[model samples]
Target: MKLSQLKILDAIVSSQSLKQAAEKCHKTQPALTMAMQKLEQDIGFTLIDRSGYRLKLTPAGERFYKQAKRVLSGCDELDKISSTLALGYEPSICIAYEQLAGDQRISQLFGNVIQQFPRTQFKIVGGSRFQAVEKLAKGEVDIGIGPWFDIFHASGDFQSVLLKPIDVILVASPKILANGRTTLTSDELDDIPCLTLKPTELPFDDEKLSFAKGSQVVMVEELATLRSLLLQGVGWGLAAKHVCKTELENGDLVQIRLSDDEDQFQSELRAFRSNRNFYGPVASAIWQGLQELY
Candidate 1:
């Protein structure tokens, strides 16, 4: 089907009614219905079940709607790039990273994108990888930097580049450590009240906290809260060294450094995006900057 048809279909999926969808597309109800009919006939499948007062997509229709939206979004990106190129203007890139990775990762990754492409502007935000990827699917953001979360791979909406690896370490409040017990052998961490960042489903070691475990467990809402909770002496959280840099530097936090065993957990910063999304000038600039990082 045509790009306009796909966009109209996507709008119908969102508006949920013929009247609303037609209003959204600035067309009459009959014209909108004809468009839907043409699309369904071309695709050889029923796109929606019109039995309800509010429109709902059939199972096959829901699937088509998703794919169609991505195609339309890609077209929109191409239009934006073509227009910008004609006007001799540098494009903008919006980046979102898992807050768990912290600002250091963004600064190291996209910081130079700003300097290299003087005309382009970069906006960086922090959240969970899931949140970042969700925004990417909606074509709201250009690139995402974070760990390679398994769920994103499962969904097929993400492409990733692995950066540096790290361990998920359990960090205790210095208040508890002040009893001189902060110096625990690696074995003692098993029984500690660790603030886990991972969800209960990942294939993680039960006995050994990947120290990086909590990054996977942390939800969008809980990501920022974990850092504050650690500061409050609530419990130990498993996070990257960069994530807690300020606290560690200020002596408010410390890693449970293991002397006998080398930390082997391999969490890494990964750059990602949806398949249909375009990596225009702004995105390329960020990639260029990240390439120069140590």
Candidate 2:
């Protein structure tokens, strides 16, 4: 019934033995046993199955513990929120980014933010293509860092700071190249399976500067999967140069060229946020820091 009793139960379930649980809870085995006994008496049911060598939760206890865990998690979040509010910062600020965002830069920015505001919780969500921008538009995230397109800027509801420009190039395994030719005609390109990011809220148009616009596309949600497929000669697709830098250098993957530079395009990576949301201290610090760091 008491939160302390629930804590004891949690420790017992997590630890290898009752003695280990006692150490984890910072209480003697007898004390922990007495607490659980009192808890069972209050609820009029046995919570632990003691007949077995290893302790196991009874059917009723399993159900009760599931609900109790939720309460404990809620309490933890409530404490974090209270502490964050007391420090005059947002409870949490989430950064949604695509694979194109350089890992080194993102890590450096994240580390700086942690050092500046240790009390604020930071969440990082990874998406592909325009999914980060879509999350920003829906207000699901406090910030988005990914490829920038004029269509995204045309909305005028978001503000962005440009980061590095990424070169998205069409690549495939060398095994698939017949006669060692890197260039593929439009008809030939369409004949090959093209790994691409799944469509987001943004409209799809062949007229837009997209690599897989006119290909036999195989949509994937993650960049790693797409890269794996390309490595296995499963398909050809466009990917950021950095994402496959090692592959290209090692000759595991070869860039497939198209006429009129349609095989590659420069995508500007930008950190953007909605203007509608009021910026808290933590969010403002992150926004400003990204601009300075990138």
Candidate 3:
């Protein structure tokens, strides 16, 4: 029933003699004979029959020999796989982050880690800050990337590492602008409503050049809906510059600065997960990579 017995059976079958099989297996003939007998008893079958000086395989014995060969071959394959893992330099790591940071920040971090560990694998996920952070908390994601103003204020619930500075841009359509992509004072934005995907309120320093309360801010949390509203030229919004790179490059959208804005950069990229088992190979690999990006 054991793999050892199966291998002996296979060797005996190929050698066609107990003496040769015993020598091939580095065991005495009597040991090989008893092993075969125990194997047949365990399987409830007759595996071999003695004939004068040679051996003949019974129906069950022939079947067992065929299976034994396969089993031995499989064992050999498993050993090879284990040995390769131990010897190879490559390792795999998984990560989750915003789509905006996937090709940019995430890759930048990966580049730093890969220089030291060239044969490492990283599984990347692209999602919003909310979705990515939730995954990290649930142990579904190794790292979360997003603006974590809420998480930072939550305090002591998790750990975070901050990267480069970030500032949400004021994106507007050409139709809404007379000067078109130039800077504007806050008074100019007072009459203009902003498009958003969700109902949320966050503060920004607008006293430098403009001051206003309650612009027609449209709520849109979904990317598709947000993009659609953005294309409509209905209002202006505070968004990550990287998120609209394609639109900006294609002349579909332009950034209008609030005049004399001193608090231009108010955000930073952060990576985090809930406190748990964080020292696994995956974590070590990604943290090493993401730190460079930061």
Candidate 4:
């Protein structure tokens, strides 16, 4: 009938005797009995079995308590949300990160930020090339972290901080370069398929990412899929160094040096948020934490 009565019933159901329940609830046994008696009278049914040595819930009591427990759990959550709101924290935040940025690093960043604001919910999503920026533009996410592109800078709608540069090296499976060639020319790769991230938007220049002028291009929606295809010798393409560090070291995938000056690629990653709307404390904390961690 009341939250206090339900709480007393919960304690009684959990304990071995009325005396124990009274001790747990910080009340006298008589007061505890009186409370339950009032509650049962209001509910129009007996809620406890008193014939046994240890008190137990009646069949009806068991059903009623099941729902009561959910109410208590929700109350606890509401209390936490109210406290968090009082401190001006966002209840939830969503972040979109480019796959090339490395998952382990992002996980570490999340771990650090979570320790600071444990009640704030976080939704992390891995995206393909330029996908993070696209999500930011569409207001689909609270924050975006990925390689800095001219388009992002030109937009002027985002506030950004530059992080460390990520190295992107051209690589291929050893089987694809079994000829023992230490370096390759664009013409040499002309016949191979280039596995690349599919463009998320139109009017984007694919030429800037092309390694071979005549190579057949395979558009992949995810980096994991592209890496798997590269491992199978399906194609040669650019990959982030950290993403393929183990494979490159084990000789499963070999870096193909281009004859031209562009064999190795490096791009700075940026953490940015939309300038259109004001962000809450949690979003601001995460954005600052990212800049510090990176």
Q: Who wins the lDDT comparison?
A: 2
Q: What lDDT is reached at residue 49 by model 3?
A: 82
For model 2, the run of ten residues with the poorest summed lDDT: 203-212
Runs in model 1 deviating more than 4 A are 14-45, 50-55, 88-90, 101-112, 115-121, 149-162, 174-222, 246-251, 254-264, 273-280
RMSD of candidate 1 to the true fold?
A: 5.9
Which tens-of-lDDT digit does each residue in 36-139 have in candidate 2?
A: 99999999999999988889899999999889876876675566557656868876788997877866866887888888887777888998778888888655
lDDT of 3 by residue, 231-255 (tens): 7887776667877888888878887
**Candidate 3 local accuracy as lDDT?**
0.66
Q: Regarding lDDT, does 1 or 2 come out ahead?
A: 2
State the lDDT of candidate 1 residue by residue for 1-294, as single tens digits.
Answer: 787788788878888888888889999989988998998899899998999888999999888777877677668878877866775554666787767656565565555557767877667776652566566655678787766656566544676776666556657678756465655665555455565543432233133433533222333246667777777776666667767777888879877665655543556677777765556666766665665553
By summed lDDT, which 10 consecutive residues of candidate 1 come out lowest?
212-221
Clashing pairs for predicted structure model 4, backbone only = none
The candidate scoring highest on TM-score is 2
- C-alpha lDDT of residue 193 in model 3: 82
- Where does model 2 exceed 4 Å of error? 1-87, 154-156, 203-210
* lDDT of prediction 4: 0.80
lDDT, candidate 2, equals 0.81
Question: Which prediction has more favorable TM-score, 1 or 2?
Answer: 2
Give lDDT: candidate 1, residue 90: 46
> Which residue runs does candidate 4 get wrong by more than 4 Å?
1-87, 103-105, 202-209
For all candidates, the clash counts are: 10, 0, 11, 0
